[model samples]
Target: MEALYATTTGLLAACGVYLTLRGRTFPVVVGLTLLSYSVNLFLFSMGGLAMHGNPAVVGAGTPAADPLPQALVLTAIVIGFAMTAFVVILAMRARGDLGSDHVNGNRLDVSREDGK
Candidate 1:
């Protein structure tokens, strides 16, 4: 389970980084989201991967799961959502004003064509 979790997190972070390096606004936004997800997963895992554990509020003899990571992840998710929404809106506005969806307000193909 630990190996699987680590692999999944690593994959997400790798993909997120790849997409983020793209020269398009949409892909960058998606990449940022994926990166956030990876971070959330990392943060959550820091609290331990206890399965069938009791809640932190419980006074059972068994060890209880830590609630701190859970709370942090939840908060991060909310913030990530808001940030994603804002970035989307900003991208839309940039698209409208610049007449292009590229990160630099210019099409890569067009620039390449011009160089030819």
Candidate 2:
């Protein structure tokens, strides 16, 4: 289970990075979202992979799960959602104003003599 979880997290991170390096805005946004998801998974795993552990309450038993990582991941999720939304809006506005979705506001396929 641990190996599977690690592999999944690594895969997500790798894909996210690859997409982020692309030349388009949509893929960049998706990549960032994937990266955030991977980070959340990592943070959640830090609290341990207890399958049936009790919550960390006042009178919990020995196998109580740590609540800090859970809380942190929850907070991160909310923040990531908001950030993603904002980025999408910004990308849309950029596309509209620049007439292109490329990250640099210029189509790469079109050749330019000045090499801008």
Candidate 3:
């Protein structure tokens, strides 16, 4: 299970990075989301798969998954949402300012860049 998770995490991350380097705003945002999901899964897996477990507050007689990773995943989730929102808003603003959704190589944005 751990190996499976690792493989999945790697594949998704690689794909996300590849897609993220594209010129379109949509694919890049989607790739970012995919990468974030992989990161979350990777972190979650670090806690180890639990079987017959209890909360850490109970100390003995029970195996418990690490709470630290869980907490981190929770925090990352919220932060990731905020990041996605910010990226999306930036995409929109770039679209409005340059009248195209492409990233660095967009015609209008490129023309503007040439002026600088």
- Number of the candidate with higher lDDT, 1 or 3: 1
Candidate number that wins on TM-score, 1 or 2: 2
Instruction: Please give each candidate's TM-score.
Output: 0.90, 0.90, 0.82
Q: Lowest-scoring 10 consecutive residues by lDDT in candidate 2? A: 107-116
Q: Mind sharing the TM-score for model 3?
A: 0.82
lDDT of 1 at 20: 98
Candidate 2 lDDT, tens digit per residue, 21-113?
Answer: 998799999999999999999999997898888778886557788899999999999999999999999999998998888888875542352
Q: Give one digit per residue, the lDDT tens place, for model 1 in 58-90.
A: 556678988999999999999999999999999
**Top candidate (lDDT):** 1
Residues 50-101 of candidate 3: C-alpha lDDT, one tens digit per residue = 7676877754756677889999999999999999999999998988997878
- For residue 40, model 2's alpha carbon misses the true position, in angstroms, by 0.3
Report the Cα lDDT for residue 42, model 1: 99
- Superposed on all Cα atoms, the candidates' RMSDs to the truth, in angstroms, are 2.3, 3.4, 4.6
lDDT of 1: 0.92
